[model samples]
Target: MVGLYMVPPDNAVVLSVDEKTQMQALDRTQPLLPMRPGQIARRTHDYTRHGTASLYAAFDVATGKVLGSVTQQHRGADFVRFLEKIDRTLPRRRALHLVLDNSSTHKTPEVTAWLAAHPRFTLHFTPTSASWLNAVEGWFAQLERRAVRRGSFTSVSDLRSELRRFIAAHNKYAAKPFVWTQPADVILDSVARASRAMRINSAGH
Candidate 1:
C-alpha cells in the first residue's frame, strides 16, 4: 500500500476513491450569528432535516484533482456509474490504479463485470477499519471542514450544489499531490503492534 502511494507504476494514474455516505441536508431553525471582532461565528443549535446525499468521490493522486458525484443511493449500480464517470475523465492509454475501501457496493457483481471489461483499471482495497490510508479520505475531511460542517442546506439540491462548488474551487486552487512521508516498514510495525495488543486483549477476555 505504501509503495503504491510512493512509487506507482509508470504510465499509470493512481486514484483514491471512496464515498462520503448519508450526509445530512440540514436547515438551521434560526439564523446564524455573524462573526465579529474577538468572536467566532455561531450557528443555531436546532436544525431541520431535509434529506441526505451520498457523495462518491475520486482523487487523482498524480494531479490532485477531484472528481465526484452526488447520488440518492449507494448501491452497486451507483458505484458503477461513478466508476464510469471516472473512466470517461481519465485518459484511455494510461492505466488506472484505484485505491478504495472494501465496501459491499465495490465488490458487487456489477462492479466486478465493469472492472473485468476495463482491463486497464485496477483496484486496491485498504485494510478494514483503516480508510485513513486512502488519500481521498483526507479530501473528504477538507470538504467537511470547509463546506459541509456548519453550513445550512435547506434541501438535498442545496447540499449537492455546495459540494460541487467546493470541489470545483478545490481543484482550481488547492489541488496538490499528496506526499507519503512514512516508510512502509514503520507503518507495518505499528500495525503489527496494534494487532498483537488486540489479540492479547481478546485472549484475556
Candidate 2:
C-alpha cells in the first residue's frame, strides 16, 4: 500500500476512500468571545447537539481533490451510493483503484455486487489497525481541525452544508496530494520498536 501511494498503477486513478462518521452538529451554550489584542478567542465548553452526520470521501491521489457525500447513516447502502458518485465523477476510460479500511459496511453484499458490476473499479485494503496509510485520513483530520471543531451548527443540515462548503474550498484552494515520506524500511523499523516497547510495558504491568 505504501508502494501504491508512491507509484500508482499505470493509466489508473488511485483514491483513498474512507468515512468520517458521527460528526455531531453542536451549538455552544453561549456566543463565542471575540479575540482582542490581549485576549484569545474563547468558546463555551457546553454545547447542544442538533444531530449527527457521516461523511464519505474519496481523496484523489494524483490531484488531491476530494469528492464527498454526507449521509445520515454509515450503512453499506450509503457506501455504495458514494461509490456510485465516484464512478459518475471520474472519466469512464480510467481504471479506479480505491484504498480502504476493513469496515463491515464496505464489504457488505450490496457493495460486493456494485463492485462486480463496475469492472473498472478495484479495492485495496490497508493492513489492520493501520489507517495512517490511507491518504484520505489526513484530509479528514484537516477538515476536523480547520472546519468542524469551531463550527456552530443549528441543525444537521447546517453541518452538512458546512462540510460541502469546506470540501469545495479545499478542492479550489488547499487541495494537494498527500506525500508519504518515510521509506518502507524506516516505517517497519519504527513499528517493530513500538511493538517491542508495548510488549515490555505489558510485561512490567
Candidate 3:
C-alpha cells in the first residue's frame, strides 16, 4: 500500500524497477551520419537479425540516477542480478523500497524466500495492468526512443558499451524529478470521456 508520493528518507533509498523485453540487437553496416537541412541520411532498409536482449532498469527517485543491464535471458536469475545491481548502486547501510511489476519471476517462491531474509528491504508491486505507476517505465521509454530505436551495433558487447555510454551521458544532465500531473479525479474524468466517445462510436457502427 505504498503511495506514489511516499518519499524516501535521506538515509534510505527508493527504487523503481522494470524489465523491457524483446529488444533487438541489430547491426547496421553504415555509420549514422548527421542530416543536413531539408535532407535526411539514408541507410539500409533492412538490418542483420541479431538476437534479442532483455533490459532491466532501476531508477532512484531521490537521486535521479538509473542503473540498468541488458541480459541474454529474463529468468529469475537475471532478475536477481538486476536487484543485486540496484543494491550495488545504492548506499550500503540504507534501507530500500523497491517498486516493481508483479511478474512471475518477481514474485516466485524463490525470490520471496530470498526477500524474507532481507528485512531492510521492502518490495511493492504496481496494481495489475498498471505498470505505468513505476517510474522506471518512463526511463526505459526515454532510453528506447533516444538510443535503442533504429540504432546499430557490431556485436552484443558493442551494444552494451553504447548503452553504458549513453547512460553516463544522460546522468550528466539529469533533469528535474518527474512531476505527476492531474489529480486522480481528473484522470478518471478523462477516462470516462474517452469511454463515452467509444460507446457513441460503437452505437453508430
TM-score of each: 0.89, 0.88, 0.78
Task: Give candidate 1's TM-score.
Answer: 0.89
Candidate 2 displacement at residue 160 in angstroms: 0.5
lDDT of 3 by residue, 1-205 (tens): 2344344566777778888887777897666667889986656656776777778877777667777787888888888777777767677799988888878989767677767877777888766545666888888888888778757976777777767777787777874465557676665565466557757777999
Q: Show the lowest summed lDDT stretch of 10 residues, model 1.
A: 190-199
- The local distance difference test score of each candidate is 0.89, 0.89, 0.74
Q: Give candidate 1 misplaced runs (Cα > 4 Å).
A: 34-40, 191-205
Model 3 worst lDDT window (10 residues): 1-10
Residue-wise lDDT of candidate 2 within 33-105, one digit each (tens)?
7888988668879899998999999999889999999999999999999999999999999999999998999
Q: Which residue pairs clash within candidate 3?
A: none
Write the residue-wise lDDT of candidate 1 on 161-185 in tens digits. Answer: 9999999999999999988778788
Better of 1 and 3 by TM-score: 1
Model 2 residue runs over 4 Å out of place are 34-41, 188-205
For model 3, state the Cα shift of residue 91 in Å: 1.8
Q: Output the better candidate (1/2) by lDDT.
A: 2
